[model samples]
Target: MQFIEFKKEHFIHDEKTGNYSLEIPKDEIGFGDVRLQKKQDDGSLAKIDAEIIDDLKQIKIILESPQDIRVNF
Candidate 1:
């Protein structure tokens, strides 16, 4: 239950679209407790959906939501 800043090396941002791609540790998604949240203008967090692809060692989160803002996991 850690809040990761979007500026870290764990993510990729798409400037053309309001979306992001992130890579995380395999253990982080254990039991499917992973949840995606986007930062709102009011400095609050908003829930967003993502496409998580579990590769062998890491999990790839392909965010489908069009939100070009800070996010936490």
Candidate 2:
């Protein structure tokens, strides 16, 4: 299976409060403060945790160029 691993900042670091510090912009509902997101097979964006990314080093393929992926505000 292929997956898009986002950078660490997008995940919620504070487990106790479960609060994601990044501020969300008013124009975008779930993406205002997000630094990165994973693109699902169905073309949906899912919120990802930084820890998951850290553990993904064992089994990830690095792409030389962008294919069908795009990030926009």
Candidate 3:
């Protein structure tokens, strides 16, 4: 298991909406072991929603939880 930092080339950033979309390789997910978290001011992680792409070998994550949050997975 590896923690990969998201890069610009990793996904599509919509200039109009100012949203980021990321795709994770399905192989990297062991038994669908994936999570979404939003960092809090108290240094805590809050779980968020993540969309899974069943047709493709990847998972799609949209960064739209909280503006002051540093979202991670």
Q: Which number leads on lDDT?
A: 1
| lDDT for each residue of candidate 2 in 8-47, tens digit (9 for 90 to 100) | 3443345565543332233332222223355667977754
**Candidate 2 collision pairs:** 25-32
Off by over 4 Å in 3: 1-12, 31-33, 49-54, 65-73
- How do all models score by TM-score? 0.54, 0.24, 0.52
Stretches of model 1 off by over 4 angstroms after superposition = 7-20, 27-32, 65-73
Which candidate would rank higher by TM-score, 1 or 3? Answer: 1
Prediction 1 TM-score vs. true:
0.54
What digit string (tens of lDDT, one per residue) describes model 1 on residues 1-73? Answer: 6454453344577788766687777665453445567677787877656776776777677774445334334
Query: In model 3, what lDDT does residue 13 have?
Result: 73
Error of 3 at 41 (Å): 3.1
Candidates in descending TM-score order:
1, 3, 2
Model 3, C-alpha of 57: deviation from truth (Å) = 1.0
Sliding window of 10 residues with minimal summed lDDT for model 3: 64-73
Which runs in model 2 stand beyond 4 Å of their true positions? Answer: 1-34, 51-73
lDDT of each: 0.61, 0.34, 0.53
Tell me model 2's lDDT, rounded to 2 decimals: 0.34
Ranking by lDDT: 1, 3, 2
lDDT of 3 at 72: 34
For model 1, state the Cα shift of residue 26 in Å: 3.3
